[model samples]
Target chain A: MTTPTPRANSGPSGTSDAPAVPAVPGPLAALPDADPAARERLHARLVDGAERAGLLDVAYRTLETPVGPLLLAATEEGLVRIAYGVQDHDAVLADLAERVSPRVLRGPARLEQTVRQLDEYFAGRRTRFELPLDLRLSTGFRREVITRLPDIGYGRTESYARMAAAAGSPRAVRAVGTACATNPLPLVLPCHRVVRSDGSAGGYAGGAEAKRTLLTLEAA
Target chain B: MALRPFEEIVTEYGPMVLRVCRAVVGPHDAEDAWSETFLAALRAYPELPEDARIEAWLVTIAHRKAIDVVRADSRRPLAVAEVPEPAVGGSGTGGPGAPAASANGQAQQPPWERDEELWDALKALPRRQRAAVAYHYLAGLPYREIAAVTGVSTDAARRAASDGITSLRRSLPGRTEQRTDAGARQRRAHQREERGERP
Candidate 1:
């Protein structure tokens, strides 16, 4: 199948060229279709500095992935955000300020339960999360994409065509891919579990290597 | 090294950050998390080393801010009790949660039940595990970074995440049953409504 053209607003390079759009967050453009484990390692390394800088909360994670640490964060009302990569420091923070709230603070004093819960998860003790999420950041089709992502089974993978079918539009496979690409919260929504019908690893917003790593980890 | 004011950073990466936040928390909470992340970034930016990578720094802040939001929000009662079965929102679904089945007026299932179930599943995992799952599965973080964020050794983090997945897999059967039961009930309710009878 012919590759879908990048979004109209994207630059000639297919990366967002808006002067304000700093280097497209992660190594999305530079990625090559390859092994999952290495990509996971790279994804892990990329986000270290950001986590240390206190830009990330280091909570709300899933176990053993191909990519580096999974940091899921949110607003007081619900999950409003998530982040990846070591270099995502400013990017993650910038997103929160622009989307979640201006009253942000560092104290887990507020996210006490979430922190505790995350601690429990990493300990290999807990399985699921029980948190409220504020989904104000998504709307229209995007919201639909996230809301529907959870329907994918754990361990099992689906193709874009199958995913589109599950999402209720057999014809909108490309749109579903876009949704996956644009997904804000990848794991919680379980986007990595998605693959091409031919079993080829598809594109991921977090980077293809990261995606491969996640798929491998899941397989492991 | 001192970093540029967060405002400058936000102006530059606002949309990307919001996309990340939105990916994790959904749309409704993104605004608040976004605000919190940037504000926190602003307060902490000055302390960052000059050689610091701004993008990573911001992502770290955003992740923390997002956790704060999830924690606080978890305190409130969830709107629904059942977690949705994990389904690919597929490109056909108009994104992830597009009202696909309902869009073409196909056999409509209650989206609320699925939403509740999915949220509960994510919330059910411990924070680190949840984050790992979120990153690898959702945000697509690798084991190494997941280790860094959660303060575990890379292997430990990988194990923790794998363990978490195992747990999800183990629990998924049970959750699927519950979800199925819930879906059946909803379908019955719809049927009841169609019959035009209310007790």
Candidate 2:
């Protein structure tokens, strides 16, 4: 295949009286093609610099799951948010920029360890997520409820009343439901393990279907 | 109005900056210049005006980075034997008629590799002319922006680019005809494919 030169009208040679040289291809077309590996390396380097300079406010990556794509985001503090594809990925990112900081980037390398744990968890090989939790998105009673969720364990289910009691307010069962409904980091925190007192799956941020899928995945 | 994520900026202008870097500093030092330019851009991105022309901003940053690499090269004596391979992956030693792929993945003969005369001619131009040509022709910057970046008047920037192109054409006679023919052939093939003629 022959490379197409830039249009003669667009280049510096356009108005020259000299014999029309073939419009030199712009450096973009003329330069050697970029290697995928080299591009990845450059991205990694940029992320490293941004992290060092404290310019990276939020870094996120999307993971394809049996359920759907999951958006996982983190700050320098730790993994901060996880959302299902149904949550409207772009809207989630916008909210993250507002609530956290506007300096966000899609840097997958930053979530390497988190992704590994998630992979193992989805495969049912890991019973727990050992990564640092950033719970800044939840606060007060909601924060208290989610903070107690990890104790619900890998395959076990707990009632909303039981979660409320564990959070030190048994009467706040409805609040516990609200907390579970808004859990910022779902699977990692195991919030889906909370069920209704009647043993029915309660409301879930990832939708009732996703909650059931997680429960089934765990039960198996 | 919020600033776009620096990631988008990188995606949109990364290749353009890479090309500018390669043209200004040669392929060997281009990657370093490209990396440094982006790193610097990221650091200052939050404060950049929303209306700022991002392409010009990136090109300006690349210009500074290329100068840094050149200055450092001059200070540290040339180590011809130890010079690292071109960091972006190609050998930068592809011979005339060597097969190279375009960004779109088509197997095309690289004109730059085939016509070393053009590169030599570019290098022979004055520094201001070389930069003007690269920014205006390669980066597609306006004469005003090129003038601002190169610290020359707009008229001077235009003249530099024009002179640079004239010199290249004079030095590399007959090369244009080959490229134009190749370009015409490619356009025909493209039209054929668009019309569902290519199998």
Candidate 3:
């Protein structure tokens, strides 16, 4: 606070020399806080500009569902990353930043259909994920294994050994687990359909319970 | 730590950048400067080090964008020659040429738009002084930071902001009017009209 002890007067009309003139807050002291509508308008413009310039490398959002909040991300091409709550959404996003372009955003316009289909699937009304997908996050044998996930069909379960054999390497069953464990597009790519050879739910990146939830939903 | 999603960055610094842009380029071109600044930033944001001072980095980009706006303004055809009559300000008064004045003056004009006297005084300051004032006062950067951002010496940046404030006080109108209850209420209303915050 200003002490209100005016600087000693060196000039006449000492009435003007007293407490408040210099102590008063100046008009320059602050600016009006940013208008929310204006901020939103500007943000929308920024998003559009970034997209136009091909700088929106990734756009994503979180969807609340029976499984948990899924972090769905898309590139300019298609849906690229999906993360379950246990994957530590923040950590998953950070990994995406490291592997994919760091120019990621939470703008979900790119994921509208993805979100809608997911909602329907969770509601047991739809069983297929016929969405454009980006596979840049997976490569080699892991990629090959996940690429065959959708071929298993809805409401059908395949054992890891059988899924591995279908991926053309029967003995690579554990590798199939690794591939599914790292499946970037888990639910959409149908990784939950893979089960243990003994008919038990296998470990899932979304945790075993989430996998059961998906399988049960499919059965329903 | 992994960089946060870019939306958070935009949410955090967008307003400060807008204010800096307005102080340097005027309200007419401030939004454009802000847009360009953010777009450019989003392009280069991936490589930005997390430890860097985000505010200083944003202000730096805003400074460059402000320059671009000023340059673009100077190149406008209307700027080439003064007509016999300049258009009057505020809404419904001018044609398409005055988009900024009319388009942004909807229900209530931004406080910066209403504070025409402050705008004039700020505009009259030398470009460096204006920038220094904005970076220091509005953005709350230190003199050293102003120097780093504007590429001037610490002493010079300090002098520019200090001198800018000195001149601003002398030339500014309506600063000493907060004593009246009506004046206080009016100022608060203008603030609330444009924003929910004083910062």
Best by DockQ: 3
Ranking by TM-score: 3, 2, 1
Interface RMSD of each: 20.2, 8.7, 9.7
lDDT digits (tens) for residues A43-132 of candidate 3:
666766677788999988899999989999999999999999999988887788878877887676789999999999888888788899
Between prediction 2 and prediction 3, the one with superior lDDT is: 3
**What ranges in model 2 sit over 4 Å off?**
A1-29, A32-37, A51-57, A160-178, B79-115, B173-199
Could you tell me the interface RMSD of model 2? 8.7
**How far out, in Å, is residue B97 in model 3?**
20
Give the winner by lDDT.
3
What is the per-residue lDDT of model 2 for residues B34-133, given as tens digits with 9 covering 90 to 100? 8889888887877788898887899899989999987876786666313334344223322222122333232242345444555567668787877876
User: Which candidate, 1 or 2, has the higher lDDT?
Assistant: 2
Residue runs of model 3 more than 4 Å from their true location after superposition: A3-25, B1-4, B47-52, B75-106, B171-199
Choose 2 or 3, whichever is better by DockQ: 3
Give the lowest summed-lDDT range of ten residues in model 1 chain B.
Answer: B174-183
Model 2 CAPRI quality: incorrect
Model 1 residue B73 CA deviation (Å) reads: 38
Candidate achieving the largest TM-score: 3
Pairs that clash in candidate 3: none
